[model samples]
Target chain A: MSAPDRFAPLPVTDTPQERGDAARNRALLLDAARRLIAERGAGAVSTDDIAAAAGVGKGTLFRRFGSRAGLMVVLLDENEKAHQQAFMFGPPPLGPGAPPLERLIAYGRARLAFVHDHHALLSDAGRDPQTRFTGPSALHHTHVRVLLQSAGTTGDLDAQTTALSALLDADYVEHRLAEGATLDELGDAWETVAVKLCGR
Target chain B: MSAPDRFAPLPVTDTPQERGDAARNRALLLDAARRLIAERGAGAVSTDDIAAAAGVGKGTLFRRFGSRAGLMVVLLDENEKAHQQAFMFGPPPLGPGAPPLERLIAYGRARLAFVHDHHALLSDAGRDPQTRFTGPSALHHTHVRVLLQSAGTTGDLDAQTTALSALLDADYVEHRLAEGATLDELGDAWETVAVKLCGR
Candidate 1:
């Protein structure tokens, strides 16, 4: 069966009528939030700190992102979108113009790096099982499923996709890193699994 | 490095000096909780309902297990111990006598079934990332790591173990089931991945 058209760019849900300064304020808040989170960790960075750093009123922060969790979701979404764009469109291996097996290996490495880097934000954004498998995750599932199908992976495609995707989960990746495995070691292992699964 | 002696049976923390009637009451309450949870779902079954169904007072239930969350931990521990025993000491492929690759494959299948069966209880017991990588999860990691080492699998055994264990996670299993994949299909996919990783 053909894969569904699930890779269309995520919907741009921002209101179209927002004035220029409103958009600027939104960027300022997200930038400040990301910087604070990087310095102090997600839990330690409060909404008030984020607003003060952005030089905006706390009310502006709320008006832009609704709540602290909302800001987290948006921050995570931005990073996820950039990562998605690289894999979906940017260059060889991780994007296109490479053999399926090679692309698959590259995809795993790239995804491991992305999860490792954004572990804090991604973990804070969603732990709900219902939401875990939807949105960007659903798209990720489709991407891996299509790649496996192309590479002639013979068993259940959906299950294979789920298996691969699970390896890149933010929590799992963070746990491994904490246990003293380097990111390079993880990327190499992921490549090994990808090659084996692709029957290379 | 030798695998740590992490597979020793989990410590039995129950107070050994309890009276026979207290032991019976604890058993009664746990049985009732399990039955009610199986019938109406874990979320639907309340502490009051469990006490009422077990013919025990609400105070007795609290005195026995401390709180609803504590009861859930004990309930999940009971199931986990049984699973651990089966794999560690019970019989063959899932136990000891079989080849390492075959045992790994069997382990994955058995673990998938265990997660699928107990998804609700496990999902409710702990979603905290800190708690996730400890306790039973840590033991599982060691088990799979030892199996991979025995199988002579090359490159980053820890990462490979994490990859395999992540696939059998409760939330991942539940999400796949919700998406309509069968347990058998998951097992087959897991076996395929295990065989490939083991170089069979």
Candidate 2:
């Protein structure tokens, strides 16, 4: 008996308009959440409140986002993607155009800046342990791993990648923020550590 | 008038018997907890049940250990202090007599071993964020920081300490454990990283 192929392509649907509508609604929900968080706080904003604020029904809100944490996750996802894109493709040492080691240093700096700038959103979204541990996109890890490899780090690239991931772990970053460390200092320190980890 | 002295002698008392009693009770409570966790797991063991298992009243149990999380913390404290002592003063590469780098590596290995052996206790005790975050004795940040300093780590010791602490953060460690990495691998990898950070 031959093994079944799992690679059969499924029929594709042209759902451009549907996708656009979903995107718009997501923006509205996120905007509503931010407004609520700004006016009150992340803890003060519930799914029901977000739905009412967004002018959508609670059921629709749940259908779209699943839960309050899920909605917060979407907010974080939007910001994280934006940051990732900026670092991966946008400009300067953080973008595709820089020397590999320079890019690695810039990535850490940019990441520290991002975390500092969006402290509240990250904290609120990461309150759920499941979300904290696994909600981050694989791209985030991949992005750093690629940079480490490109930077010519010696000895066990996988271990270096894991160590780098630990550096970017949300809770650790948040703790530094809570300790009142400045973003610039964090960025500088990260550059130092990154250089050491990546070599002379 | 002279400038008043800012410090005063601590009021001291001999409480040897009281200390001994506390230690015995602590052992009893921890044993009860271990048994309960064995039978029903950490989630199922309540403070009341713990008190009953140890043949003590809930008030006595709470007085001795403030909450269920606190009780768990005390249990972990015993284990942590033991490990701390071993690294700080016990013998060989983990003790004061070894080369700084060797001691650092040994300390990491010992720490990993401790976590592996006390996995359930740490997990259970750390259920409450407040319990995990606060308390002078609970967070081992300072201990690790001191070790890094003594190991002759170059540059900003404070920053390196925080970065090193990030490496050992419980959430990250637990996540890695769940991802199927062995304790020995973690210990070895961390030994490498610690040596790098210590500029060995």
Among the numbered candidates, top TM-score falls to 1
lDDT of 2 by residue, B1-200 (tens): 33453364432222455687676776687789878978986757888899899887788777677677777776677567777787767997887787777877777677766766666566656555466555423346666677778877776565665555544555557777777877777777787677788776
Question: Pick by DockQ: which candidate is best?
Answer: 1
* lDDT string, candidate 2, A59-106, tens digits: 777766766767777777767877878987798788998988898888
DockQ of each: 0.53, 0.25
Which 10 residues in a row give candidate 1 chain B its minimum summed lDDT?
B1-10
Candidate 1 chain A lowest-lDDT run of ten: A1-10
DockQ of 1: 0.53
Could you tell me every candidate's TM-score relative to the true structure?
A: 0.74, 0.73
Docking class of 2: acceptable
Per-candidate fnat, comma-separated: 0.77, 0.19
